[model samples]
Target: MGVIDWAIVAIYGVVVIAIGIIASRRQTDTDEYFRGSRQIPWWALGFSIIATSFSAASLLGGPGEGYTNGFLYLQLQLGDLLGYGLVIALLLPFFVRLNLTTAYEYLEKRFDAKTRSLGSLCFLLFVIARLGGLLYAASLVVATVTDLPMGAAILLVGVVSIAYTVVGGITAVVWTDVLQFAMIFVGIGAGIWTAVNGVPGGFGELWQVAAANDKLALFNFSWEPSSVRSLPTALFAYGILAFAVAGTNQQSVQRYVSCADEKSARKAILLGWFSGLVGVGATLLLGVLLFGFYSINGGLPADIAADGILSHFIVNAVPPGASGFLVAAIFAAAMSSIDSALHSLSTCITVDFYDRYVQARTNEKQSLRIAQILIVVWGIVGIGSAFYAASTGKDLLEFLVTYTTMFLGPLLGIFLMGVLFPRVNSSGAFYGTIAAVMLVIVGSNMGWLTFPGIWRSAITAPLGMLLGYGISLFGQIPPQRALQGLTLWHSSKQAQALGRPGLEEEVPDRGDY
Candidate 1:
């Protein structure tokens, strides 16, 4: 990269840190740090959610999948779209109505302390691994451009992300996302433009190349069970992943519950849905274009990995200043994901564990201090984990992602059981999640599950839901008055059957900010 490009990257980093410091000024307590004081406009929260979703996974992995297998991967976006609708229509009401700080707190209200603790632990594991993957991916981009060791690149990315998140909390995370999202668009746009103009005959020639190679194919209507990447199966799996990530994950739920109103939250979530579709389309289009570019020029080099194609092209083909912008976009994607996870992890610790158990009764100021301390602690731990992955020289990201999926099916299932199935008891949810997890481990490793390949991924969540609900029926505790407004059906009938208004109305308006 040229000096001007390097300067842009450096200045961009400095601007993000400054945003963090400026944001820190408004936060007087844990509520602001953890909740964004519930004052951030819905549009900003929505944009932040989009930015977080546009992580290195989409920037690199999306294109890699497109390059490898054609546009069939885009089918997953259909399920993702449906998942967002489900979240806004079905999931957001309970989360927002509960006035949650960390989304897991709703589990405690609906279930038991043990269940809440379990949920929090799942969130921590999920986000920490996700953070590592983003860092690793960003490191790959740096290694491609600067010839730096992957470990060193990972450390540099991690430190820049953690620096701001530890100070400004969600405030910094959201505001910085606004800038990062712009950089992402510019970078992705640059790739698309180059792919088109670099080819001699433009869209006509690109189409001819893609058509000849069958790279434009987008489906597998065949009824094969083990074809995990098939359109139907992939769509279903992506839906499950989105449901878990958007509906049940702390990072997303924190944003939903932090909105000014349900209307704002819903709109913001819809914006996320829109962003997902648009962003995936852009990257996939790039993949198609690159297919044409390489076809006419000659095939990819023997040593160039599939993942490295985009990075390699940017470094070697694109102009230096432009390459730097693209690199900054990669960095921006990493920061978007890491900062949010740091804030979410810190909230879980402070609200779920520290405040709930250790302090039990800390004031707002005390809570704020603990939140900051946990933020720094978790940030350090996340960076250390990234360094560990780099040092081990293992393809550890995939293992962690696959391992996390074992929990996703159960985690999403438990949340559904709580919100949708009123009969599912705390004991049932706890045991059912445990059962699904154990079975998933055995089934995934042994490759003996009746459900084929990634079809198993989609099926596991419903299996978990059924297991939890069925077990609760056997235990059969009597219905109680307190169950009102916490579950979907219960909340509706509270006024008619119990002669009491909904409990959500009791969620305090803490506008003290």
Candidate 2:
């Protein structure tokens, strides 16, 4: 990389921090810090969600998967659309009407305290592993470009992300994400352009190479149970995975719930899905271009790992200034994910646990301070976990999908059981979640489950849902009073009739800036 590229990277970092500082001026309490006081425009929230989704996993891993296996991976986008639809249609009504701070709070309202606690814990495990993976992937990019040790690069990335998030909160996170998304768009466009121009006969020659190698294949209609790239897995299993992510995960739930209205939230989430599809598609195309570039040339180097190919290409093949912009995009992707996770994780700890249990009487100012402090603490812990993630020697994209399936599957099952099944009791949800997670762990270790990583959630979620519903049959049904406004079967009018609060809370108008 040349001086121009290094300068572009430096300016990007400074600008991100500046956005955080500027956003901090409007902060008056935890609401603004965590939810942007529910005043952020829908477009910003939608764009932030897309930016966070990119992470290092998509930025690097998407291309790697494309490079290695071609367009078969893009099938998962179909599942994503299905999942997003389910969440919007089935789940968002409850969340938006309740004005909940964290997604797990709904578990407590619908089920029992123990069930809520378990949900939060599952989310914690899921997001923490993701935080580590995102950080590790981004750090690998930095290390590759600057010749720094992995640990130092991890620290560098972690500190920059933590600095902005801890100060500006979600305000900083969403706005910076908007800027980062632009950088990512520019970076990926540059990468594709460079890769195409580098080929001997340009896109036509690249197309020939990709077609000859079967890299343009998109769908696999095979019914094999263990097939990871099969159409069924992408359409069905991946849909469940997407629902688990968009519907149940705190990081995702937090985004839409911050919107001023359900309509805005719905539009924002859908926009995120569409934008992410475009962004991810571009990255995958870049991967195909790389494969084409290498095939026509001498071929990819022997030592380059799947995850490292993008980084290696940027450093060696891209023009100097362009390489730096690509690096900046990678940083943008990493920080966007890290910041969102840190805020949501801290929100879980502070709202779900701390405010709910430890000191329920604390003023909003004190709670806000605690949330900020927790961000710093979790950021440090995430950095430490990144070292562990790097040692696991897994592909970045697959590594995240594996962990998401393992933890979120059962968690989403419990949420589904709560909303879709009115008969499920708190006891059933609690025990069912415990049983489902345990079985998944044991089954995978014992080699009893042999399907693709994405299939784990598809299998486990239904298992937990059925187990929960069955157990509920043997237990006392929850009173109709407690079910109001919590389940899909329960409407806001019914809640109001039963002397419960209606779906939407009337928050006083407040300035976001």
Candidate 3:
């Protein structure tokens, strides 16, 4: 790396620290720390959501997927689109009306404390798993370019992320995410430009080479669910996963709730989903370009792994200044995602467990301090888990998908039961969750399900809902009074009775927003 590249990375780090300091001055209470006082603009939250959902895993692993597997991976976006729509129509309004601090709070209000704890537990597990994979992905670029040990790179990324997230909280996270996304977009553009230019002909040659080798291929209409990129797996399995990630996961839910109002929140949700589509498309195109570049340039070395392809190109092929900028962008992408998850996981722990069960009467000042401490704790845990992730030797992007599918389906199922079937009591939600997870574990291990790991959510989510609903039939239906403002059927009425405006009540759009 040249002097300019190192300077750019250093400048980016300074700016990140400055943002944290600025945001820290504004956070005096838990509400401000966790929800940004419900005053952040929609577009900013939208960008944060996109950054969190896409992360370093997508930024790096996407091109890797493109290089190794062609366009088959793009089909996952189709399922994710449907999932976003479901979140906006069915889940967004309810979450906004209730004005929750965490998504799992709905579980407590709708069922019992135990169910809420279970949901929180599931989210914590998902975050740790996801955080590890993300850290590993980010470290690949750093290690490739700077010759840093993988563990040291992970530590550097983890410590930096924790510093900003702990001080700035959600407010800092959202605004910094806007900057990080810009860097990531530029980095993608540069990668594409260099990859295409590396070939004899630019776009024309890329098209010819990629098409000749089937790198431009988009669809795999195979019937086998075990095929990772098949249309059915992408459409059905990924569809369910998209909903769980966008609608049910705490990371996404926190972004929606932090918006100034339901209108802004809905708009932000749409912006996030659509922006993600564009981002995913760009990364995949960069992959195809890489394929063409490598094909004509004597091909990739046998020693490099798929996940390391983009890093290899950035280090060896790109101009010095731009290469450094791209490396910094990878860090930007990692920080953007890592900060969001850290803040959200900390918020989940504080609100769902600590505040609710341990110290209900603690003042806001004490609570905020506790929350900051948790961010550091989780940051350390994340760094440690990344070593395990690196050892697994799976493709980073698919590993992310597999991690999400493991617990998210049943968690989403519990939410569905809470909102759609008031008859499903707390016991049903609890047992149903357990049964679904066990089924997913056995199916994944025994291979009796005859489907790929991505299909875990699609197959099990429905089973969880059915099983939970059936169990509810044998239990007492929750009192209608208790169900008010918590379930779809009663949300409107309870919202009015509680003097909080229902989502149906539209607010005039202010130009300032």
Top lDDT hit:
2
Q: Assess each prediction's global lDDT (C-alpha) against the native.
A: 0.77, 0.87, 0.85
lDDT score, candidate 2:
0.87
lDDT of 3 by residue, 287-403 (tens): 988988998899999998887889989988999778877888899888888998899999999999998779979999999999999999999999988898999988887778888
User: Model 1: clashing residue pairs?
Assistant: none
In model 3, how large is the Cα lDDT of residue 252?
93
Stretch of 10 with least lDDT, candidate 3: 504-513
**Residue clash pairs of candidate 2:** 97-503
The TM-score values for the models, in the order shown, are: 0.92, 0.96, 0.94
Candidate ranking (TM-score, best to worst): 2, 3, 1
Better by lDDT, candidate 3 or 2 = 2
Q: Write the per-residue lDDT of candidate 2 for residues 51-99, one digit (tens) a residue.
A: 8777977898878888888988888888899999999999998787788
